[model samples]
Target: MIKKSELNRMADVANDRGVTVWVEFEGRRYGVTPPAATPPLDDTEESDLDRELEAFKAKNGYR
Candidate 1:
């Protein structure tokens, strides 16, 4: 886990710039963004997209 102080500093910069902060750990990268910088998705639209993705995955034989 990242240190709290470092994470706080990164969050401050990201919030100020309206962008996301990326960190790498254990060979993987993660992003943290302020909620205000992200747009909310409509539930209906999200469900429709999920259904479409499931259908595509099934058609492609992805388990």
Candidate 2:
């Protein structure tokens, strides 16, 4: 069971790197783009994820 604080920390690191972070919890997968969401512990960010997420947020703003 992962703690919410730990998740928040991981999100912060991913945000700093301008990457997305995906997390699979409770048998569900969640893909979070930096500034809004971060990728899981996949060991690497998806190609163009930063660009893609940022553009999406710019267009729609973070919900």
What does the lDDT read for residue 31 in candidate 1?
79
State each candidate's clash count. 0, 9
Local accuracy of candidate 1 as per-residue lDDT tens digits, 1-63: 889898898889888887899999999997778667457899999999999999999999997
TM-scores for every predicted model:
0.51, 0.42
lDDT of 1 at 35: 64
Q: Which regions in candidate 2 have their CA more than 4 angstroms from the true location? A: 36-63
State the lDDT at 15 in candidate 1: 82
* lDDT of candidates 1 onward, in order: 0.88, 0.75
Best by TM-score: 1
Off by over 4 Å in 1: 37-63
Clash pairs, candidate 2, are 20-39, 21-38, 21-39, 21-40, 22-39, 22-40, 32-37, 32-38, 33-37
Candidate 2 structure quality by residue, lDDT tens digits, 14-61: 879888777788998766567645547553456568778888999997
